[model samples]
Target: MNAYLILDLSINNFESFREYIEKIPLFIKKHGGRYIVQGVEPEVMEGDWCPERVVILEFPSKENAKEFLGDTEAQPLFSIRHKSTTSKLILAEGCS
Candidate 1:
């Protein structure tokens, strides 16, 4: 089954976050993952929860997604994301 990583991020510093935006995709690609949706403001549908930026990534499998999450080389970029934005992320498997 394919897996997806969905992210809801609120950026605090775009200047600092730029590095993560530019570099993290390379890490994702290394792990057989690709961006399905890059950062974009979401439209609120039924809830009061508002998201500043949203990103969705697709991978061949859940394991691939996990590996990407745990990739050692991406740690620095992850740090940049942590420092620049408050983020909520979830990984879900698609129907087989």
Candidate 2:
């Protein structure tokens, strides 16, 4: 089965977040993850929930998704993201 990492984020500091945005792609590719969606505004169809920005990453499996999240090389970039944004992330298994 595949896995997806979904993110809903509100940016606080764009300058710092830019660094994270630039650097993270290399790490994502290294872990066999690809961006399905990146920093898109949500369009509410039926619910009251609204997100400032959303990102979705697809990986080969749940373990691969976990590995990407846990990658040591991406730790500094992750810190930049953490400091510059308020976000929620979820890892979900995809139907095969």
- Maximum-lDDT candidate: 1
List where candidate 2 sits over 4 angstroms from the true fold.
none
lDDT (CA) per prediction: 0.95, 0.94
Residue lDDT tens for model 2, 3-95? 999999999999989999988999899889999999999898888779899999999999999998899989999999999999999999999
Q: What number of clashing residue pairs does each candidate have, in the order they appear?
A: 0, 0
Native-to-model Cα distance after best TM-score fit, residue 38 in candidate 2, in Å: 0.8
lDDT of 1: 0.95
- RMSD per candidate (Å) reads 0.7, 0.7
How do the predictions measure up, each by TM-score?
A: 0.96, 0.97
Model 1 spans with C-alpha error above 4 angstroms: none
lDDT, residue 54, candidate 1: 95
- Model 2 accuracy (lDDT, Cα): 0.94
lDDT of 1 by residue, 18-95 (tens): 999889989999999998989988899997989888999999999999999999999999999999999999999999
